[model samples]
Target: MKVADNLAQIQENIRQSCSNVGRSETDINIIGVTKYVTINRAKEALGAGVKNLGENRMEGFLKKYDEIGNDATWHFIGSLQSRKVKEIIANVDYIHSLDRKSLAKEINKRADRPISCFVQVNVSGEESKHGLSKEEVPSFIEKMANYPNVKVVGLMTMAPFLDDEAILRGIFRELRQLRDQIQAENWDYAPCDYLSMGMSNDYQIAVEEGATHIRIGSELVGPYDE
Candidate 1:
């Protein structure tokens, strides 16, 4: 299908969901995830009016980044390693998967420019994933305060996918809580102002639960890989 058609559909869905829950569609940001799609497809999405694009892998995004030129702001939304940080640094506008103190420190050290970043909170406690536990957020953020180069923009989480809204809500809720807590503690939270959650299937619900930035993957690009 056409990108405009898909965008319209998703916007309509957002409007419908917001109307039901007494929220405004304008309040939420739906990032067009480009990890599964090609740069050509991403160009189509940009033409279709998408200003933000999200990618997961470093090298893949680097390839597409070189070809796409510069226009849409890119967000790095997958698990990141300290080793792979340099390649993705200048290429990304925001790093969404900064999961540990060491990783954050590493990002801080080599970062030439101030990078917008989110602390990945492992709200689901799944071993298969990488993120700081909700309990560890305070200390993590404290450690991050020492990093002048990388600015904390907010928190990100990927709830374990299943047929359970409660599970999703529980995780997203934790992210929201952490975001609020951090903000309350320091208004200078700089780059940290977003709560990135949700995907194609569960985005509406995520918005209702207070998601400022929703990482929509299949919803925008249609299905996903990894």
Candidate 2:
């Protein structure tokens, strides 16, 4: 299928997902992850009406940022290295893998303006996942209060690839619950209003469970022609 058609299908699903739960489709942002596609293909997603684009690597983001222009919002959705924060700090609009204070300090020092960030939590306690333990999130957010340049906009988590729908749903639910718990704190800096859960396989479930942002890659942009 064409990238445009793929995008249309995803959008329709997003609308239906929102309708099923009485949430407005506009409440959710579709981040067409372009980490695996060429810049030309990334532009195809933009032409198809994807306003948000996500890249997992600094080099890929920089290359695409230069080639794709500034018409779209850029999201850095990978585990960002603190040393490379300066490389992407000024370019990307959102960083979805903030799980530590050192990274936050770097972003605070490098970002010219406040940058939206999602505190990544390892909800499932998977050793391979690069996120702070769920137990550490509250203190983590509290410490973030000192980083004026980092806005605690949401929470993000990666569910292990599995076929069981119930498990995936639970993982998303955990992230949403964490977001709600944090948002309830009413911290001045941690306005934790969004849940950046879901990816290509489970975004619809994520939306139904109160996800404000979904990062979709192959489902929206597909692989590069190479």
Candidate 3:
């Protein structure tokens, strides 16, 4: 039950998934979602060779960042409040929830350098999910050019947890098409080259559909009691 064992399996899954789609396994960056686990467990993920780590909350991110420092590439993989941007802007390498202009303004104002961001899209149309609708994304990304310190590196989405593989694949494919459309624009501020989709339940399908970054939580790092 060591993290390394779990990681190996995940890696293999990624490898197989990539092969299915003619993608190189090296293209996939597995982000160990450590928000649900302790810092010690996060470190175990690092020790297991998980170079990227994701945390959802500011407090959790800061706590792990305090101990782990630059040893791991930090990803803030949750909805970020504009008020909390200053606290995490400098420490985080990637933000996977850049959905609105207000949050974008805060990140641009606070970041010393251009921060990598993935525009979150609510592809599933679920009212509970936080992201811009597909129709809103193009205009939203076009405006990102004004925020000099925020770089739109990719798009992020969360598919509904369901047993249907077809539904999961469709959601991921739509996001991938959206990413391609944005990438083709060649916007200097929004290269939009990556796809930050998938989680513990649907990463395999996400990869097959061209996910460059996958966030794994309970699978990569087991959930811990709060």
Candidate models: Cα lDDT each? 0.82, 0.91, 0.94
Task: List the candidates' TM-scores in order.
Answer: 0.92, 0.97, 0.98
What is the per-residue lDDT of model 1 for residues 1-226, given as tens digits with 9 covering 90 to 100? 7788889998998888788879888888878898887777888888999888888888777987898757888888988889888887877888989877777778877789888998888888999988888898877777776788778888888888886988887777878888888887783544468888888878877887788788876777676432
Q: Which candidate is the best by lDDT?
A: 3
Error of 2 at 13 (Å): 1.2
**Which of the two, 1 or 2, has more lDDT?**
2
Worst 10 residues of 3 by lDDT: 217-226
Clashing pairs in 1: 153-191, 153-192
Please give the range of 10 consecutive residues that has the lowest summed lDDT in model 2: 217-226
RMSD of candidates 1 onward, in order: 2.2, 1.1, 1.2
lDDT of 3 by residue, 1-226 (tens): 7889999999999999998889999999999999878888999999999999999999999999999999999999999999999999889999999999999999999999999999999999999999999999999999998999999999999999998999999999999999889988999999998999999999999999999999998888887722
Q: Which should have the higher TM-score, number 1 or number 2?
A: 2
**What C-alpha lDDT does candidate 2 achieve relative to the native structure?**
0.91
Best first by lDDT, ranked: 3, 2, 1
Sort all candidates by TM-score, best to worst: 3, 2, 1
Runs of candidate 3 exceeding 4 Å displacement: none
